[model samples]
Target: MKKLLIMAALIFAAHFAYAQSENIEEIQQFIISDVRYNKADVTPIYLDAKAYISLYRVKDEETIYMANVWPAKRSQSYGYIYDLKQTSVDATDDTYKNETLTFKWSYKNDFDNKQGTATIKLGLVYKPTGIAFLMTMITEDLNVTEFKGYVSGSLNLK
Candidate 1:
């Protein structure tokens, strides 16, 4: 009976170790795509432009970052920054009380199902009670065709 108990303990420990995934690291440049608001079409917009941009972890377990956008900063196409024309946040302390982030992008095709690609930043804010990542994305796409939507993808956390 003692041998049986010891064997069971060893097995349980091994299984527990395998059940946990690796901890996510401080990513420098993470990219994601497939940002849609509806589930109409599954085609990728900005097929030529890579999304997800770069990321920075200010608080390790919780962080946000951006890099690599469609129209770089000088192209007059698209760009991102800690500050922009749309820093509409309710932040009273001055640091964007976490309102709307400049991480905004969109695509739509009313004539023939406009596909959109948006790269919104995600932040994992560590609070006192628990850890959570929060980020916002703006979507004002009017669905005219079969599927008008928005979607976002993130890097594999582990």
Candidate 2:
């Protein structure tokens, strides 16, 4: 009976580990189309750009990659590419309601070496046909931004 119990515990631990890894792997690359920047004593500015974002695992660590974004525009067609290291994540498994995933990251600007923390909250809107995500990111500089777009894939809320 002791051997059987040990085997069961091992299986449970393995399954839990697999689930945790799969949670980060299931996120698909999605476009962050709309960006709303809110700063102090100023009206919010909205930028309609074709920025892309993706979450993936690298060397057993999860990374957040954001491409073609603001602060990098040279002419009329491009922007800076940056990646943030995933510091923490919390996910809810219940699918009956809107599933929310909160991801936090610590990033350092490569050009200036200034360090900051950012938190991204993604809400998966439950619908019948297509899946939509609304993400809000708050940075360490107290800049609040909102990103809205439709995603082709879903996040594993576990």
Candidate 3:
């Protein structure tokens, strides 16, 4: 009887592990598009770029790190890392089914001689046809200029 119980426990554990892995993969497959940026009193910049952005959860989903790399200049790449402060998943709503992630981060760009702080609010809304994303960034002290941008994307996560 003990051996049978042990085998059952092992089977349940394996199933749980597999489910967790699948969930992680779904979170990693978010596709970013329709990127745009605007600074205070400056012209808006539209980006013709596509990239796969992923969020890594650590410490049993208590900490989440979002990291993505994409092209910036002719031969340069720009990367952004955000540590999430709050997260919520709402799948019951009929209209706005989304997972919302909020973050506040501060960094120093020595090359640009700027100490910047940013508050990012991102949401992945699930539609009947596809997944849509909305992201807003509010930044300060970037080249001594405050900036804000609203960007939208289609997430191709299954």
Estimated TM-score for each candidate? 0.26, 0.50, 0.45
Report the candidate with higher lDDT, 2 versus 3.
Answer: 2
Candidate 2 TM-score, true structure as reference: 0.50
Compared to the true structure, candidate 1 yields what TM-score? 0.26
> Of the pair 2 and 3, which is ahead by TM-score?
2
Question: Which stretches of model 1 miss by more than 4 angstroms?
Answer: 1-27, 38-43, 46-48, 55-80, 83-121, 124-136, 139-158
lDDT by residue for model 2 over 120-152, one digit each (tens)? 677766554556677777887878877776675
- Error (Å) of candidate 1 at residue 142 is 9.5
Clashing residue pairs in candidate 2 (N, C-alpha, C atoms within 3 angstroms): none
lDDT of each: 0.39, 0.54, 0.51
Error of 1 at 21 (Å): 35
Model 1 Cα lDDT, one tens digit per residue, 1-158: 99999999999988775553233333543233334435443336433443334443334445343333443221112222333234333435434333333454433333345445454544442223332333344444443212111223322245
Once fitted onto the true fold, the runs of candidate 3 whose alpha carbons sit more than 4 angstroms away are: 1-29, 39-52, 57-63, 71-94, 106-115, 142-158
Poorest 10 consecutive residues of model 3 by lDDT?
Answer: 143-152
* Greater-lDDT candidate between 1 and 2: 2
Q: What is the lDDT of candidate 3?
A: 0.51
Q: Candidates ranked by lDDT, best first?
A: 2, 3, 1
Residue pairs clashing in model 3 are none
User: Across residues 81-128, which tens digit of lDDT does each residue of candidate 3 receive?
Assistant: 466655656677456566777776444443454555667677766776
